[model samples]
Target: MVPTIEMTTTWERTCELDDLEPGWGEVALLGARQVALVRVGGEEVYAVDHHDPHTGAPVMARGIVGSRGDRPTIASPLHKQVYDLGTGACFTDASLALRTYRTRVVGGMIEVELDA
Candidate 1:
């Protein structure tokens, strides 16, 4: 049997890193999905679904950027539901979860790896 090779071509370029403001979230369109690109500090970035799981509203980009202890978090602007930026786990509601995407910065450009 031949060895299978993993491909890293799923990463899609979204926007320039300079376009994002630190401690704020920006909305980016990746194909048919709306992703929220969040910039923390300087180089640290995270990508999560722009849709709020609780209200089904595409307003996550306006969510407040904050932290719960060491874990980075975003609080929904509507109901103030907190979610982990790393794991997309809902801290306020155990039953709700936001989708997370892998993000990387290359040559000052931000790329997001969407789920297949």
Candidate 2:
């Protein structure tokens, strides 16, 4: 596994898990950068860097979620580039990817793991 950087100090609560409805996404600041918190299939949740990996634009959070083969991914709204939510890997281009953050729900609150 690639070394996961400590994105924040402690797990900061962004919102309630219920706030992110299934098949939808929400944008929140996770430390110094914005992140897109996506809820897929009503069971899986993903937190990825909000910027589009291909264009460096703050648009990933607004992308659409879909599946390719057996993997779930998001398509950038600008250029339609897709990114794997689990690994932040761009589906079409191996040289590009976004940063991913670890997250969990605590007492109904959505928390993003971070460094102290």
Output the number of the TM-score-best candidate.
1
How far does residue 9 in candidate 2 sit from its true spot (Å)?
5.8
Query: Which residues of candidate 1, in runs, are more than 4 Å off?
Result: 1-9
- Cα lDDT tens digits for candidate 1, 1-116: 99997755489999999999999999998889999999997879999999999999999999999999999999999999999999999998999999999889999999999755
lDDT per residue (tens digit) for residues 1-116 in model 2: 89987554577788987889876778998668788999885546888888887888898878999989988899999988888888888888888988888888778887886666
Question: What are the RMSDs of all candidates, in order?
Answer: 2.7, 4.5
Q: What TM-score does model 1 achieve against the real structure?
A: 0.91
Give me the displacement of residue 107 in model 2, in angstroms. Answer: 1.1
Give the least accurate 10-residue stretch of model 2, judged by summed lDDT: 5-14
Clashing pairs in 2: 8-115
* lDDT over C-alpha atoms for residue 63 of model 1: 99
Q: Candidate 2 versus the native: TM-score?
A: 0.85
